[model samples]
Target: MRTSRAGTSHTVLWAGWAALAAGAVLCVIGWYGVSGERFAERQLPYLASCTVPGAALIVAAAVLLAHGRDATAAARVEELYALLVAAEPPREEAEGERPVAGELVAVPGGTLFHRADCPLVAGKAEAGPVDEHGRAGLDPCPVCAPDV
Candidate 1:
């Protein structure tokens, strides 16, 4: 058997993590430089030969640049998903409420309901809604769409 791992957000997350790692390394180098003289005697031969603050600043800049890009990517993804769902038009449920357009399943007493539209089948799921009293209630699965 073979396996392939990919998802809509995987690329974005990879890019983010890669950038984060690079930035972290840069920050470490930069901080080392800014604190050079304080630990000159403990410095590595090659490291002692370089400008600490300069190295540190470069690292810090790399980190910041990567961090900025990562955040931008994440925000863009959210915007896209929002736009997709928004553009699809609203659905009306029999309850006179907007139908939960996500995935649904069976509850135990009736059916476990969840709010996702994934194609893969799933097991009983907890209700994603919260009541005013701060308690969660299991509602009808949208596909099976049982009454509460």
Candidate 2:
């Protein structure tokens, strides 16, 4: 079976919960055993046999539970990523239909103008020369900062 980054087994996770429940029961049993006893020496046996072991089981359960949760989250993220990767590819323009070199660019409704090669305008479909929209008086892009 495909495991997550943490590689924690599902069996371990189930065991953790089982251990936690059993530990709780053991602790309760120990408490009851000690509470009914009249002497301190009588309670010591319950502490040694039940309470101490119960507390140890709880600590082990905590580690197992945390590991299991991390693995579960990692697996979920992997599933989401697989789904994203399987989605349809975006449409592309023919080579002839693409914009030519030296196409001045700016984002629509944006304040700055940039050269076609500007990193800010790169890969943006909406970016085009201001004159195409009859827009004017825009400031130069601070990054590219084209003189034009």
lDDT of each: 0.47, 0.78
lDDT of 1 at 142: 48
Error of 2 at 36 (Å): 1.6
Off by over 4 Å in 1: 1-50, 90-148
Encode model 2's per-residue lDDT on 24-140: one tens digit a residue.
988999999999999999999999999999998899899988888877787878878877999887665566544455666778788887877787867677776656454476787
lDDT of residue 137 for candidate 2: 62
For model 1, how big is the CA root-mean-square deviation? 14.5
What ranges in model 2 sit over 4 Å off? 1-11, 84-90, 132-135
Tens digits of per-residue lDDT for model 1, 1-148: 1112223345445655665565566556655665664565565543644444345545655665566566667667766776787795444334433224442432334424444342222321332333233223554344644343
TM-score versus the correct structure, for each prediction: 0.28, 0.73
